[model samples]
Target: MTEMLAHELRTARAPISAHLFVSGFTYTGMISSWLPDKPDAACTSEETVSHLVERLEHGDFYILCPDNEVTPEIDRKRVAWAAQDIIENRPALSRWHPDFAERFAAFEKPDRNVEKV
Candidate 1:
């Protein structure tokens, strides 16, 4: 899944300086490895998206949307909600709607503690 997301990002010509792969949904290590620097950040989906948007506004880097149901067009509200969940250190999965959970289940994996993030 990580590889797929990375490939999509690369194909889209998004910047590679820094990127965030929202954890708690999928545990693909590719994004962590692709980052130019160590993975010093981890957050619920919302916080990650918020930071990504800030970075995008500042021209810090480009944001890549993983091929999930959360399209960028509808992600503004989702990102804000995710940001709050992350800041509170809550499990992102808990916030998903019932319909999304059904689709997201295919991507779930055992939680692996990342030593760096």
Candidate 2:
């Protein structure tokens, strides 16, 4: 069996509260980078979305959406904020953000044990 399988995102609340949507990647630094580096640091997407929702519903989630009402302008801001937050939150993924290279190291430090010699 393959180690990975795909799952669709389902939310109990229709039109997932924008806060929740932003909270996932906002806190977790996308599905890829966040999980491996910080083994003890558990985030929602590291597990099934169902499991994530369970925790979130139980008050485990903490991102606040100051503006919950959706409007065209808000939608634009949401997308922009999420994008900026994603890049800023994870230094490893900062390359994705243009005009912000100085905010992150040019490249991750080489693994300690690797040697050119």
Candidate 3:
């Protein structure tokens, strides 16, 4: 919904841009309370915010942040798969459906454990 709104606003009100900052596995008090301990893959809220600032400074319109668990490449693959879901006329979230699990796993395997320093 926000993405659609951003596009509409950008079209109607020119010269202004709306950016979306997407984060994964952020560690906060609420999240901590849900688990016995914080996971190593989760980034602290401060770290997430700092990265957001850095990306914004770099003029990134759509920022998909990398936590310890998920890297940028993996995020890109996921986004591409999501778009394919619509284009391919598959059911919503087919990636998680049992019938499509094997295919999704194959598509995601190349991205797994591939990260930058």
Best by TM-score: 3
Residue 97 in model 2: lDDT: 59
Span of ten consecutive residues with least summed lDDT in model 3: 108-117
In model 3, where do residues sit more than 4 Å from their true spots?
Answer: 4-16, 111-117
**Any runs in candidate 2 off by more than 4 Å, and if so which?**
1-19, 23-46, 61-95, 106-117
Q: What is candidate 3's CA lDDT for residue 38?
A: 79
Which candidate, 2 or 3, has the higher TM-score?
Answer: 3
Worst lDDT 10-window in candidate 1: 108-117
Indicate the TM-score of model 3. Answer: 0.80
Predicted candidate 2 versus true structure: per-residue lDDT over 32-56, tens digit per residue: 4645563443344434355456656
Q: lDDT of each model, Cα atoms only?
A: 0.47, 0.38, 0.82
- In model 1, the Cα lDDT at residue 44 comes to 41
Per-candidate RMSD, Å: 16.2, 16.0, 4.6
Residue 52, candidate 1: how far off, in angstroms?
13
Q: Residues 1-117, candidate 3: write the lDDT tens digits.
A: 758867887789966667798998899998877886879999989999999999989977788988999978778887888888898888898889998988778888764542211
The positional error of residue 41 in candidate 2, measured at the CA in angstroms, is 16
The clash numbers for all candidates, in the given order, read 4, 0, 0
